[model samples]
Target: MGIISPGFFGRRRRDVPGLPPGQHLTEDFPVLSAGPTPRIREDEWEFTIRTEAGGAHRWSWEEFITLPQEDVTVDIHCVTSWSKLGTGWRGVSLDTLLDSVESTAEYSMAHSYGGYTTNVPVADLRDGKAWIVHQFDGSALAAEHGGPARLLIPHLYFWKSAKWVRGLELLRHDAPGFWESNGYHLHGDPWREERYW
Candidate 1:
């Protein structure tokens, strides 16, 4: 709907020489606790979607590219105090992926390989806030920025949209993620400034 604000670090104007017209630089943002740093060889990276009713689907890097795509601008608010403005990202909507599968889970948790998990309501994924992003600023995502594939849920706190995400686990109830279980907020709606709860 609206790509609201910049990310955790600081916002900068797009003034590259010959990059895409509206493309922005998302690399300056910081990666909090990079999480043992998952290494992704071209053949090793994968994205999986698991349903509450026990159905699961996995996508390789190439396969992930075959899905429908859209470019969206969203406001990403990090738990820390920093907001970049008007970041452009391209990817498939989480709802589009869910529609391809059948699930009964009321809530879901995003799972990353290095013990990272972020909980979110199933309805939220259906809303425009969530996406399985592959491109940032018209460029293939760089590894440090969660390249190949990463979750983009801007409405919630940035931690909910994990970097280097490997899969999504649909749950019937809420579960705290790596930061959430520690000290981050449960329902990290930036609109309410619910950075933590």
Candidate 2:
């Protein structure tokens, strides 16, 4: 047999900075889908945003891809105690998505294609706070990891990122989504140890 490779026997800790409380560093991004991955082709994909006032903004795959895009690098912390640092992504900023719309709504709910929903503060998703990412690490995001597009709000726990993201709904009040309704923290802040009901 060939000689064994060095550093292949176990996980080594990286010098990741600003990790939230109770989180361990991980170099590899883990897969943690809650349901079957939906395979959406570029032609069949669409994104919509519905405001509480009943106005809807929609985008088709072709149109969505044509929008201005940006690249971002951030550290993401999952509620499960794993944090991945310096993850790279390319997508439209939430600010870009909300630019034309004007509203006093205080909360935004991200709705995913597979019926996954996660709510967050409207402010948290604006001012360069979040993104709707279609590519990660220079490749199209894989299905299991929220391919086609996913919301990336790094400041909050990973669950707020909303994998397989499809749209956003604006509301005057906070509304809990899947995990939130099921006992996960309504506003998950890793550094604050906000992980449960």
Candidate 3:
């Protein structure tokens, strides 16, 4: 089943400052999920990075949290036309997590806890552009919003930031992920309004 949000066809407001083209500012964050929320215990949570060469980098929840953390404040735009501005998040940068791993892959497929997956360019995941966020709005992220951890790629449409992110598989070639295979844009740039294929 596809992810569903209540205001998918809500009226767009173009006058709002900082909103992308065809987007409206929203004060409340909406919950959209493709399936039932999985309740994962912190101790059982593990994140892995699998390389194209079949090597793997694994991090348990205990080890993951000890890494460097950064506080981020950025605007998030959803393909559904709602944009939330100045959202605060706390997480470890993808650069830090990927520093030791070596890959010539140009793309990555993010795997999430509840079987959600999204494709992203390796370049977009580096250089401090993305994060593995565990906290939102100064608190532990809520389960409905991908609590324990989620991939945060603010520059792209929100769906690219897969919720409940568990691991990332490096791919030498680009592959359409869950949404992309379902006709969502392969590169979901909010500014470009690349919502559908």
**Judged by TM-score, which candidate is best?**
3
Q: Is candidate 2 or candidate 3 better by TM-score?
A: 3
* TM-score, every prediction: 0.81, 0.91, 0.92
Model 2: pairs clashing at backbone N, Cα or C within 3 Å: none
Please report, in order, the local distance difference test score of every candidate based on alpha carbons: 0.76, 0.89, 0.92
User: Per-residue lDDT tens digits of candidate 3, residues 58-118?
Assistant: 9999899999999999999998888899999999999999997998899999999989999
Candidate 3: segments with Cα more than 4 A from true spot = 1-14
Give lDDT for model 2.
0.89
Taking every candidate in turn, the Cα RMSD to the unseen true structure, in Å, is 8.0, 6.4, 5.5
> How many clashing residue pairs appear in each of the predictions shown?
10, 0, 0
The candidate, 2 or 3, that scores higher on lDDT is 3
Q: Candidate 1's residue-wise lDDT over 1-197, tens digit each?
A: 45656664445554544223233434367776545667666578888889888889888878777888999986666667555556789988897788877888888889876767888888888967689997888998877777667899886767887878888998877878777878778887766767666
**Clashes (candidate 2):** 0
